[model samples]
Target chain A: MALHFDPADLAARRQAACAAVAARGLDALLVFRQESLYYLTGFDTFGYVYFQVLVLRADGRMTLLTRAPDLRQAHRTSVIEDVRVWTDADGATPEAALRDILAEHGLADGRLGVEWHAYGLTAAVGQRLAAALEGVAVLEDASDLVSRLRLVKSPAEIAYTRRAAHLADDALDAALTEIRPGAFEGDILAAMHGAIYRGGGDDPANEFVIGSGPDALLCRYHSGRRHLDAQDQLTLEWAGVYRHYHAAMMRTIPVGRALPGHREMLDVTAEAMAACLDAMRPGNTCGDVFAAHARVIDAAGRRAGRLNACGYAMGTTFAPNWMDWPMLYAGNPVVLESGMVFFLHMILYDDDAGLAMCPGQSALVTDAGGESLSRHPVTLTVAV
Target chain B: MALHFDPADLAARRQAACAAVAARGLDALLVFRQESLYYLTGFDTFGYVYFQVLVLRADGRMTLLTRAPDLRQAHRTSVIEDVRVWTDADGATPEAALRDILAEHGLADGRLGVEWHAYGLTAAVGQRLAAALEGVAVLEDASDLVSRLRLVKSPAEIAYTRRAAHLADDALDAALTEIRPGAFEGDILAAMHGAIYRGGGDDPANEFVIGSGPDALLCRYHSGRRHLDAQDQLTLEWAGVYRHYHAAMMRTIPVGRALPGHREMLDVTAEAMAACLDAMRPGNTCGDVFAAHARVIDAAGRRAGRLNACGYAMGTTFAPNWMDWPMLYAGNPVVLESGMVFFLHMILYDDDAGLAMCPGQSALVTDAGGESLSRHPVTLTVAV
Candidate 1:
């Protein structure tokens, strides 16, 4: 039997969110992004019913007002001290609820921070909020505040992620068994897609890369109906989201017998990936870890080593509320702190042939070392 | 048998797009956004392929390049003459291919219009392009270009859209049958999710919304799950993209009997929707159409009538991709020309609840009248 994440744990998560927000020196971080909202409140009800202007005020009052039609659910999944329903009447918008919160917190004269990531906030929401709130500062990056809180996966979260990884591995096994020279990319994708969902997953939740033959040259190649050639390299980059957590790692291998270059390229990438994995630690900067992979490629004397061979933080969503402030895109200097869960992928792409290898490796940072989520062996495959 | 849309008719859509792009006084356009790329290129093998660029010049040279992987499939779909394959060794990224097209067409030395709505060009790609070419201008608004090109729906497009709309309706029917008082929004969404995929439209493409009861109070009132109550209004926004065409519409329904105010609100919205549909016609400005809905709301003496209505362009994708500069959002003052395909959704929402007759109607702007693509009757049905 599968383990279910408890609804009660939402309260603890909310408390953790409150602490993170306060530590960041925010008055009350407006958690509007879906992932952040889910991470903080454990409210997954749709319609943004739990889509809240979550005000985790400095005073420890976790107040929320949602627009869900089922008020009980808003209460069930959330640990908010107060819940308000949005009706079809005037004075019931998020803007209105925000007004009451401001007045109650004596924030009538203080600045209210707004989360800038929502597509719903539209340009109109900003204007409307400005017109509504007298003194408010809508900051752009509340994402980092709550994002850091999710870096260390809860015990439950890791198990769920491992399960997701298992699903991906199982799907890949099925794909390898079913794939043949004459198989269509779309059909093979359909097989993988069906397996994941039937095996208990949101299939579309996992992105797929099932390119074959010469198509594997496209950096972000999409699978198609091309008859897979005998000596083609079928590169796959598919991952699934588990209970809002993420699991991403990829590998590419040959159909029957690989071409000389195909084998060389795959081996080089694997070596680079291994070097990068070995470099992960609690005290390293994002770039330092990336250099591990870059150095491997340079040592191999490849014309171009790797491009963006670094991974960003991964937790509840494919992309969390915000990537850790600094990243490994060269200039970003965000350090790898203990308890950070990063879905790292060292990838390269050729826009011309649409071939890409987003061989991602996800790991959790610890005081001792890093631990990977996937159980798939690093060995390359040659389908018989 | 499902009615298949004719690919031959896409030529007219392309003509409209080419004309719209030219009218913008630009030499060439770089299609980066998925909807625009599909609209122009029509190659739909797993969308989300990395940077498939469609470059159309003023002299009518339309070329699509990205990777060699898609080159063979590209031949089967695209009508464009230059189907260049971008290989890793070729050093041809989509950006590079775009630059070459511009230089070949003498467009590199001047302003080249681009899809500003796209995510930032990847740093690596940007570095390569910027180092190669200097003094290039990027224009942000091509809304007019898309609006005009995609405005008029071909007979084939309309049929596909009609079927798409019906598919959503069919999916909703399946979703509701599984909805019980204690059933979860997540479960209901999952049920519909299975039906849509099994029905053979690939995946749901996006997450399903199953908010009922209090969850309906949220903006875009939908989410993963919440327990449904007998007293709650079950609302859904759904669509299916079949053959790369979008058919979206929404419904607000009660799980059991209508609540005290649900029926009245529904009736008001229905009346408002009817008023808007009746007023749709050619030669009318989008502003005029918006005003027509506002007038109906005003005549009904509802507190606010126009606050929730939608101005949508009809095609394969929803929102902005269907067309260019010819949008129906507020402040857009385009003339409603004949042959345009658009949708009118009149809705009302606040903190307490959301009520509306949505995806109000799909219509073709004609010299004589407005023709609907789908004709499902508007009514409240108690689950039998």
Candidate 2:
């Protein structure tokens, strides 16, 4: 078995999870998040898109109920011994199968914690599960129990994150070579992804944000690839992934010449990013970091151009994005810790002026302050 | 604006959706699926990962409620005129915003259709939405209403599918050049993706499945990659995407020398694939196609190796998977129709012998039968 983490580490994680469940007075946890499954048992598969769950009792006893496609996957990639399969038919209700399993494990009438905020647990399936266990058990929304535990990374996870950061820098280096005028955005994107794969990195949890010209003002990824104009702005938000752990970075590069006030906005963004990093002290809250960013941008009189949220936590995540819990927004109460990692982005989009400037990178919170994981310096280099 | 589909095509799709909603006695549809939003308005963004929905009324009026990042995205890429932004606060409940929108549209007490199967609508959010609108509206699970309409491709959609198929073939051509003894799976995957991007294709809905060694027996994408041994089996399942329309293909290649009984299994898989295609004629149910595959595989005494379901219908899809509605499993009653695209995969994995064989391709259903979309033939090639 090619388990990503050491068996001892995984065992420790399972023990901690069991302790958490016991502390919450829950009999078991119905884990529907793929990240939690991978972190606890090393069970890795995209089959979570279907009706799949890992039941972890307070005593650390575990069982996985999944589809036929992941039957072999559970056996090969995970340490869990009890793996159950649910057949697919026209009206296959796997929740019924799960109820039977709960009965077998003497938990039919027990209180269970559920990862209800997970992408794996769609509303339709949740409704079915609720109905199946209506008179049997009490379902509690303990969606962030595992996520809170994962916010503080172990040493091995940090090593993987650092490697991912290196790959992110390498991807940016590759993109710089292909970001000249008249270059196709598709080719630039291909080069960036190819660099990560060649460096033994894995596919990112989400699509990279690549937009040029007026589209550069947008932050999300959209379809359609266009060639760079002689004078254009290109915004890129990409992550390097290794063992499913991600280190993301964002930047908006100018082709040929920078836009009006673009250089000044870049300076303000850099200052704001520095302030956010400085606010990532061990005693500070996530809101402090966002406040720092907002203070700098608002003081610069660029409030109209700034995004409300600066950035978010980053770790091992699956599709549809790499953003983790404890987003850096105003009034968030999450406290910063030494091992916590974050992506701090200062994005400014002047809609009326059709100009954009964003500078961001991943950082690991340390005893002193925040330390950048990436080797790339934050600077606006015009591509000629 | 860079709308992928023509304005007329989008208008027609909206009319069809409105008709479907009215037929179901629904006053409005709360579309949570990203594919539905993209099909209805060409509004493309991964922002659906947040609390975002497109509200379409029976009268053909549409309004989008999304986060700040997609405010520009909806305006630039889609034809939607009304785009509302939701702030990202600590205790923000966008469901309340949705309720207010419904009330303003005079649908407070009206029956509404909800796409409950969407990844964007997590169980937690669904619970919140239900609580927020309790006694104010009636919600119905109309998950497949838009999906059934999207299953059958229009002429314009077919053009994009054909282009995607060409890109899939090109990706395979590139993969073949890198698949040899002692080849790293990462490099081969990079080559395939690079080829697709160079051909002006978009990012696929999910990560490509690539496995060698014993992992080749598994069907789902898992973490960790391996190198091809001197004599190994490599299984690859990938798709080419054009404007979110997918044409997927799967193949299991042999390295250096074929496994024991592998060549015979390949022949059996090919024969079974041919039977499946022939069974996809008009008026035939999806179950009939699966029965044909089962007949051929079981008759060849390879029942132990074959999968329960052969393939699934494919069209415009979003993250998590490219497989659409109406999977080709036993007893499925969905009838085949013209312009419906299906990916027919004949997968065989013999655990006893540790052999794997999968030969698959996308095809469009016609009045006559299924026509293969890919130019690449279903034949096993041994890499020396």
Best by TM-score: 2
Top DockQ prediction, candidate number = 2
Off by over 4 Å in 1: A1-207, A210-235, A251-274, A294-306, A318-333, A344-361, A375-384, B1-34, B37-144, B154-206, B216-234, B252-277, B284-307, B316-335, B343-384
TM-score of 1: 0.66
Give, for candidate 2 chain B, the lowest lDDT window spanning 10 residues: B301-310
TM-score of each: 0.66, 0.99
Error of 1 at A339 (Å): 2.7
User: What TM value does model 2 have?
Assistant: 0.99
* Two-chain DockQ for each candidate model: 0.11, 0.78
Evaluated on chain B only, what are the TM-scores of all the candidate structures, in order? 0.79, 0.98
Q: Write the per-residue lDDT of candidate 2 for residues B229-307, one digit (tens) a residue.
A: 9988899999999888999999999999886688999999999999988998889999999999999998998887335
lDDT of 2: 0.90
Query: Across residues A1-384, which tens digit of lDDT does each residue of candidate 1 receive?
Result: 011346567657767776766666666766665556667666544333122466667655766666534345545454554776554322336676777876777656543445644432322344455566645444435545665666667778777767767766766776787676665555556556555544555433324545566555433422123567765666676665556565666666667675555555656667767776666687787677667767766676653432542666666652212223334544345677766666666554434434444466667776655677667656656765
Candidate 2 docking class: medium
